[model samples]
Target: MNQDAIEVRGLTKRFGRRTAVEDLSFGVARGSIVGLLGPNGAGKSTTLRAIVGLLRPTAGDCLIDGAPFSALENPATHVGVHMDGFGFETGITARRHLEIIRLAAGAPPGRVDEVLEEVGLADDAGRRVKAFSTGMAQRLGLAAALIGSPRTLILDEPANGLDPDGIRWLRRFLRGFVERGGTVLVSSHQLAELEQVVDEVIVIKRRALFAGRLDDLIRNDVDSLESRYFDLVEGAQA
Candidate 1:
């Protein structure tokens, strides 16, 4: 198995005449937490979708564990992904939702209870998903992604709708997860929040603008990640 959790080389995606991502290349080391940062329509989602096999890349390839992700025999065990929306059954309780995913992924039943507690959803396990607030739904989504104990986690805007406490919990939880030898790839417009937890950052503007450690991205300047993000985007436009 490869030590790199994810590898993308010359990735390109086009929607008609617009190029969403162009020649984007980056590698994520195993057991590290990396943030994917970009403005609206900066191809952050496109790049993530391509990596998780949600969308076929027009060019280039995405590899997981040193092999083509598309060829992975059991992708669910290899890569756990949570996108913008919750894939919940509204009428089902949180426990039931987790039960379903655990069974579908062929994971052990104990994992269901474990992840619910991990995301602070065990107390609300009996509540129907329809009654969940946006924050609660986001927590449920995270619980689902963690149920199978995947080696790699790809989350797009995982912090969406989370309250201050929830965000803090997520940051700490992600740090713990990475500490335990898991790989995390998360994309968020909330750079400030991500900066608190991400070990490295891949900043994409019209294309691959910067890819390096978060501190290095701002090493020469004392500006915050958000300010540096804006500067990178503006420089791309110019």
Candidate 2:
């Protein structure tokens, strides 16, 4: 039987009196790309953070490959995460930044250049991080994530700064990643772009509104993903 790559089980989080995520649960099957979709501040980030052990959830835990992220042996090799507020030292070159991560992951030294090229950042390897454009920075973040050779990637809004060409490249890259037996859980607001790549999608707003195959969510070809999403989200509004 195929194991789920990620499992968010009854995960709930609250800061003081404000509940961010409540009982948000879902699964990402191995070798698949799953989209985490929600309107702004719908606890997407909280769910992801809990999955990666970045913060302690108030009511639940997340499991990766059947183990909690903190419990996985050689955790970096099991999962790679790229999110907002990834602190990068502005003074270092992109190559140096990735080299540091690769070394820390105990990955082969040469993986740095290989991953940089994989993310289309080879030419900019020597450029200081401070000089990088938004898209370039996003690429650098991806390179850092892949440097560990993890089986799964958890990315939040990775396509935010990419131009159309770069977005297309990202779509192909993600598909190729899953084809190679890797898994991905990505959160992005670009529903149209996401519709092209994700096999399953988890839509949430402080709670899960939907979770299942993209086709099932759309119902039929006549209905669009965006239109269906609006209906779901709007219907949930109080």
Candidate 3:
């Protein structure tokens, strides 16, 4: 088996005249959590979508565990994904939504309740998705990701609607995931919150700008991640 959880080589994406990502390459190690950091319109979402096979890359390849996402024998069992603005059926109950995914993923029957409790949504299991709060809906998305017991998790802006307490819960949950040999690739515009949870990060400005250990980037830097991020991005633009 490949040691890297994910590998992107010479990745490029274009939309008409706009080049969203260009020749991007990086590897996420096994049993680690890495953050994808970029300013808005910097192609982070496009890159993530391509990695999960939601969007075909204009050039190059994204490999998960040494194979293309579509080439995986049972993709759901290997990768869990939560894209930004992920959708659910508004009229469907949370439990039913998860049950549907469980069936599709071929997971065990009890997996729905297990993930509901895991995300602290068991009480809202019967609640219609349309009635859910933003945080509750985010939890439901996370529950769907956890349903297949995947070894690698890909989440885009997962902290968008989370409160302080919910963010804390996410921190713990992701830490536990990496501790148990799972790999996590989380993309977020919130640098401070991401700084708290990531071991390393890949920073991009429509291309690969920096990819290294988080401690290395922060070392000898007095400013917080937000400040440093501005400096890096502004310098790149200049």
lDDT scores of the candidates, listed in order: 0.87, 0.91, 0.91
lDDT for each residue of candidate 1 in 1-238, tens digit (9 for 90 to 100): 5568999989999999999998999999898899998888888888888887778999998888877778887777888889974478899999999899898888998998899889998899999999999899988988889877888899888888999998998899998988888899999888789878988889886478889888887776578889888888888862
Q: Estimate each model's TM-score.
A: 0.94, 0.98, 0.97
The whole-model C-alpha lDDT of candidate 3 against the native structure comes to 0.91
Per-residue C-alpha lDDT of model 2 across residues 35-123, encoded as one tens digit per residue: 99889889999899999998899987799989998899988889998999787999999999998888789899899989988999888
Write the candidate numbers in order of decreasing TM-score: 2, 3, 1
Clashes of each: 0, 0, 0
lDDT of 1 at 69: 70
In model 1, the number of clashes is: 0
- lDDT tens digits, residues 1-238, model 3? 6579999999999999999999999999998899999888999999999998888999999999889998998788899999875799999999999999999999999999899999999999999999998889888999999999999999988887899999999999999989988999999988889989899989899888889888877877586777777777888962
lDDT of 2: 0.91
Tell me how far the alpha carbon of residue 134 in candidate 3 is from the true structure, in angstroms, after superposition: 0.5
TM-score attained by model 1? 0.94
Q: Report the candidate with higher lDDT, 1 versus 3.
A: 3
C-alpha positional error of residue 18 in candidate 2 after TM-score superposition, expressed in Å: 0.4
